[model samples]
Target: MDHDETGCQAAPEGPILCINNCGFFGSAATMNMCSKCHKDMMLKQDQAKLAASIVNGSSSSNEHESVAAAVEVQVTSVEPKSVSVEPSFSFGFGSGESSEAKPKEGPNRCTSCNKRVGLTGFNCRCGNLFCAVHRYSDKHGCPFDYRTAARDAIAKANPVVKAEKLDKI
Candidate 1:
């Protein structure tokens, strides 16, 4: 059992203290209070760092979409506007691929690891349809800004994505 500042075991009756100060799922209080401090449990560093990054509107290791969006935003921000002097933010979403849609060519094999990543999360830059193990997140870390990647993923997965047919081609 964990104890708080007073050396008394954390009370099970009150709100259980989160095991880590930055827990997103639950708290350590459910188990017990701090053994040393005997106080409410706090989030651990890894969890705290993740939570802080999220709060700051940045991308986290767990959220890949956030990383992608952050990247797009960063890419756009660096370009200077010739006509407008005022700051502006745009929310343009990505084009979607239909489930029924078939690739006109052949399955895109990753040149690096040769894994069949399918069309999902394909990195246009490297021409790789790699599994998560070979993707940028695992390699270069989440490239997108947490906020942008997260928002983009959410937006992409939401109702906005309409399935289109490529039969016209």
Candidate 2:
């Protein structure tokens, strides 16, 4: 007969009452309890859990404090002092120090043709990087058994279901 602010007709019987008997409309969520009652219940539960934790923690507090004290003493005794060092400069090229070395092969290079594939390179199951041309298993002669893997996946997805045998009276 009456409509709410959203212009939807109110329930013919009545608004659903809260299971907590709080005289408020029940929310399907929060297990049919009103928002206020649900919030209060949650707060009470949290306080109870906190009290239990405090009661349990009191027993182990002394052990933790002793370990913390030991750690603090060790940290204080081994305090590191600041040290300063001047940088040494070398003005010679090819100084036999070998600061940088060039690698024969890099990840960006394709293993098939040694081409610089960069981000376009594909890592095959054969444990080698290949360009678009040789990315397929057939192209690189990949040793991994794809047929066995496919069969296992199919078997796992479609499990064998056997009906239970029933004895006739």
Candidate 3:
């Protein structure tokens, strides 16, 4: 907005307010503003900064998307795809080959090596899918601690002993 639109004439004496005109007791709280007029100017500056940040952030996200696309390309190159062309017997009607090709489904990959694994691969209780080699929690560097298993086993084996110990304690 222009200086005229602000309705705030330049202060003749003070940096804050028009001491000659309206005694608008100014707010010095933020942006050195005596009134809403100055806050409007600051708001525009803040919005500009926010817009610049968003533009810069979008560039970084484009870089990340490129890396993901590269990975997808690599996976496609590594896999062998067999295209099955169905024979169309229909001259005008239908032996019926589907116009669109169906996407091929591939086996699940091991989280550790990114190698394809069959149905025999293990899905760990810790929630990770791995191959037979890293099937065990210990091998996969799983964070699940099984210390409670021993305690549960002992509690089950000597229930009376545990009851006596608890009562004594």
TM-score of each: 0.19, 0.36, 0.29
Alpha carbon deviation, residue 67, candidate 2 (Å): 14
Order of all candidates by lDDT, from best down to worst?
2, 3, 1
Q: After superposition, how far is residue 161 of candidate 3 from its true place, in Å?
A: 5.3
Clashing pairs in 2: none
Q: What is the C-alpha lDDT of each candidate?
A: 0.50, 0.68, 0.59
> Which candidate do you rate higher for TM-score, 1 or 3?
3
Q: TM-score: which candidate is best?
A: 2
Model 3: CA > 4 A from native: 1-106, 161-169
Clashes of 1: 32
Q: Compared with the true structure, what per-residue lDDT tens digits does model 2 show for residues 1-169?
A: 4466669955437567789897898766777788999987997785465445444765277755543332222122332674443222222234465533466765587777888898999998768889998899888788889999899999999999999999999
- Per-residue lDDT of candidate 3, residues 77-112 (tens digit): 332565433222111123465434589967888888
16-104: candidate 1 lDDT, tens digit per residue: 54455443334364444334333322334444554466558766565756444432222333345543232222223455633243559
